[model samples]
Target chain A: MKLDEFHLERIQSQWENIVDYNLSESGVEPLRLNELVPHNRLQREILETKLGYPQTNGSIPLRRNVSSLYEGATEDHVLVTNGGSEANMVSIWNMLHESDDRDEVVVELPNYMQIWGYSRAFGANVKSFWLTEGDGAWLPDIEGLKDMVSKKTNLIALCNPNNPTGATMKEEHLKAIAEIAEDCGAWILSDEIYRGAELVEQRTPTMWDYYDRVLVTSGLSKAYGLPGLRIGWIACKDEDKVRDLWSYSDYTSIAPSMLGDRLGQMALEPAMREFIEKRTKRILKENWAAMEKWLGENEDIMTCIPPEAAPVCLVKYSESIKSTELAESLIQEKSVLVAPGDHFLLPQTIRIGYGHDKKKLVKGLSLTADFLRGEE
Target chain B: MKLDEFHLERIQSQWENIVDYNLSESGVEPLRLNELVPHNRLQREILETKLGYPQTNGSIPLRRNVSSLYEGATEDHVLVTNGGSEANMVSIWNMLHESDDRDEVVVELPNYMQIWGYSRAFGANVKSFWLTEGDGAWLPDIEGLKDMVSKKTNLIALCNPNNPTGATMKEEHLKAIAEIAEDCGAWILSDEIYRGAELVEQRTPTMWDYYDRVLVTSGLSKAYGLPGLRIGWIACKDEDKVRDLWSYSDYTSIAPSMLGDRLGQMALEPAMREFIEKRTKRILKENWAAMEKWLGENEDIMTCIPPEAAPVCLVKYSESIKSTELAESLIQEKSVLVAPGDHFLLPQTIRIGYGHDKKKLVKGLSLTADFLRGEE
Candidate 1:
């Protein structure tokens, strides 16, 4: 029952709202309800929705829409959850529960730590392989993962279009990782919540395409700009696997909110899905300019790998201060908030989220620069 | 990492939509979004809400409204969760996490099995005390609970306006239970989700009034008829205990949905809260009449203790068939679904939900009666 504190979430939960310029958000400015349901017919349908439990797994249409994102998947392959957080939580729990002998978890590091924290919480022997910085790209250590996993590994977790660094794994690399997991006979849980919010034209590859024993967890929170809906899902090739995950979710939050399911279904309709993704790309493009300018201005004190996807990039600082202390100082002195690298198990770095409010992003960046200069 | 199947929820999830008549639902007909936000001001506010993560712990106004339900409490004393289900899940997890030595959970049985299942799932030694049927009331076995608890009992969980039986423990009895928990210095978790849906005029007593070491879990899903909103909260006297519970929720579902937080605040505005409760009372009153008539007409084959609260009642059937078999038959032959008493650890009975449409209720009841008599 003992859980090490999830420092990233705990710090954000405490400071995100109170900070004057919060640069800690990792998704684009969220969609307002009217924008999400632009047509009167859809709005009316939403209003008419009985605030009842939607299908506990997910409504058929919602699941169907979610399934459409993955080739050859059907409604049976999906289980809708409250958020991507739960999607990862349930999938991990299910994988851990499915096999009694395999109690070890291998994780991709410099990633979102939800899986890492939860794996440890569930009493797994959590081992990690890092995403190392080299030549302006954060690269996954496939060979390291090959060495780290074993017959005892029940699950291997990955965050594609990875958190903090926003570095993505190529299809070939994902295949190699999948093969590593397969060698150990472990299920792969790929957290692809950042799939569509790519900086480049090529869509990031999914672990689902490479492995039979894969559970892909994604939601509207990151790429789709609908975090408030709290609609996330776990998709697998095997219908029974998804069904088993749904049973685990039954013990968590029973169902997604009614509006989340209905509106989320609308958001995932082919055209609307394209529109939301395009909007995310557009916003990320616009905001990244301000971030680029700030990084350019503070090149003497800060450097970043330039995120390939997602709305965030981790900047390694030139100063010797601890990442937590640096982040705390930013909050106390400049009223700006950014995720400290310490929470991601990397020190002397900070993750800047540039997905929300261009002006605030600029102001937050400028204030952060001021703080960095003062430290110097 | 293994969990017992949550039969009640599993069965309901599978058949609630498939059945022609679903009497397995425990709450009244859910409120549509339009009904929940009838006023234009509220509607506009909802439409304008940016679908982003609200405060992860819940928005200030929502927590304030939740705290308002308990005397001498503040927003600091409350943590908004996905549903009353998560409220209980987090509270139990927190209590178990807080103390390592205490691993046993004493539960009130013939109850909603969520806490029971989750307690065992979390690796706690789960013990139970029963609710005995006597003189048309389901009475708590307080003495039996005292016998069940010890220094090792970490928590005691209760359902007020109890599930299945619609039983409400008197305030004096609740105090006695609290004193028994106090003896072992254990936390008490009272699921008050069904508190407001009483058939009688008097409100059900709350554990918050009696015990300092108590977590009262309630939400809009049940008594308020807003299951779709999925807004639930935990209220405790100690500010720090609520804070600790919020940390566990960080690993579950980070926050309630954005619309849930916003609209839930409006729903809990004093006037709106009163209106919703009155509407629930009205629906229960109108529907229970038809239920009463059906009970009277079928007295020869079926008997019920006449529930004092909630929209559900457990009907004891004369047939010797297993409760699961009878429920399966009801679903297959009658196209009606009722919760099997076996799911609640009591056989030869079925829990009927009569809070929805009265016509459907009547039809479902008549079909149930036909099914019961045919077994003769």
Candidate 2:
């Protein structure tokens, strides 16, 4: 199948290393082995074992731990993937078949490009369901979402707390979304990669908790700071879906990396997870405040509603400048990188990633301000 | 996007753990960290760092080293994949765009199910080119293969030092195959995953060395005995194809595991690879003899040919018994496991793997003999 160019990855590959003050990333600084290993972890023992191809499904213990996170699920309901990327890819590729072209996929816009991008590229009748600013917060238009799902709808795709926008969906909103899928007999594929990065005490409700047919995708890359491990999973209560993904997984990546699998199992240990969550919460609190203060000072130039969850929030700039142009100017002229909202299908915003090094985040924002002044 | 069940994986998943003596795998004994580390390798240092995402295209050094293995090719032509599995998947998925229904894929029979399964699953019109047993040996019908490829052919899929059968194509045969693809303007995807596992002094000829449009896929899984690392790559002199794979990489697994990347780079170090090759050679020589002797003892019941390259060979047995039933009974009664050739679309044959623990290999073969005796 011929595919369109992946816009976000193409842009990041260009700017990630070349630019100094980069902000395009969507996760916190990665965890050091020392931080994750408090002397009793899999650091030594796992490294010593025969690292043959990991269990094709996943390590049972790892799947067990992952299943424990979601209610009414077991290891039988989980299939570990290469990353959250594969988890999303398999869910779309396995569930949505372009039979007769009547199958529709309702995808939220101004979000991670992969979900909608894949649904559109592989011949799904994709309907872009927009998430608009509502009462000083970012939320999907429930009525619009409801309208998008019909008898022909095959899947409803979502990322929460959403990519780029850092928007958390309310339980009532998710229930409404689930009811639509239920009524239409469509599947719900919720990519909850940023689920654990919540700023509020109450966590973002997992989509599976609300929907019976939900396939929840998540990984250690976001809040766990283990993107290097490339460990992610697809969770559902349905045995058929799990087995279906297993077949697709065989054709795709086969299974997660064995070394990564060992690391993943260790990372999900209750103690390690608690420690990581606390550490992530601290980092997010510190960096998010710096970003807020930086935006407050440049109120005339930029507008950003504080993210209720996630490590990042979308920052809107003047409509006169294209986000790509601003982003290019930031990286090329000032060595500061920010994600152009154009790729996210929003033209005048930049995704500010404050989950990285605080000093780089401050400098990146400062350079963006300087670039804006020059644009005028 | 709905896929047929991956039958081999399904069968393996059921029997792999239940079996005590497993001869189903395709690689030599897996490496322990102690064997891989001689005080100079990456075992300790890589464990200390923050394992994040590796370079998306592959780590530069790793690509550079992989390129050095192929004459006239540079790092620009390499795209590291999750495993040989992903390498084959992406090459097929990226290059074969089912633009018109007439695009055909020519795949070798009595081979890894994935090679042809993926081609057929992705909507390509697949022609099964047979590899026949002639002169008491496995030989590809070159004339038949030539007939299969025409102007309409999109891909000629092959696994060199072939899976199950362990048949290595002669250099003349490879060039002739390449000429067919070159004549038809079709791409040749050569999965040379067993390239370095040759039992003879002359190594298997690489597909890219002969064909300009060939994608040669190999990994540390076989010769290097590091399947646990999950490091595999696609080597093509065609720069556009390399870049095309990079884009497909984004949609699939994104990148190899960072820890795997570091380990991959180390595994490719000239000294380390030489050491591994020597060690692998020693193991293969010793183990292959044991297998040959076992087959010699069971000569009346089973027929076999010596493998010129890989550590496994497909053994054809008496037609009265099905390989799957024989395999099931062997593993169930004696806890010995071997691959059923029915998954390869051939019955009355079992893929016998000799690259395992010597004692287990001896024990497994004895049990197989007992099972065969009881069958008679």
DockQ of each: 0.77, 0.65
lDDT of 1 at A188: 88
* Residue range A208-323, candidate 2, lDDT tens digits: 88988898999999978899888989998899878877887888767687877877888898988888888888899999989989988989988987887777789988748888
Cα lDDT tens digits for candidate 2, B21-49: 88887899988765676563454565577
On the 0 to 100 scale, the lDDT of residue B356 in model 2 is 85
Q: What are the per-residue Cα lDDT tens digits for candidate 1 across B1-376? A: 4568889999999999999899999999998999988877777778888999999999999999999999999999999999988888888777876677999999998988989988888788999999998787899998899899999999899999899898899989998998999999898899999998999989999999999989999999989999888899999998877788888888988999999999899899999999999999999999989999989998888899988899999999888999999999999999999999999999989999999988888888888888887842
lDDT of 2 at B3: 64
Give the lowest summed-lDDT range of ten residues in model 1 chain B: B367-376
How does model 1 fare in lDDT? 0.90
lDDT per residue for candidate 1 within A1-376, as digits (tens), equals 5578888899999999899999999889999999988877877777788999999999999999999989899999999999999998898877886678999998889887888888887778999999987787899998899889888989888899999898999988988887888788988889999999999889998887899989999999999999999999999999877878888888888999999999999999999998999999999999998899889988999899899899999998898999999999999999999999999998999999999999989988988888888852
Candidate 2, position A285, lDDT = 94
TM-score of each: 0.99, 0.97
Give the root-mean-square deviation of each candidate in angstroms: 1.2, 1.8
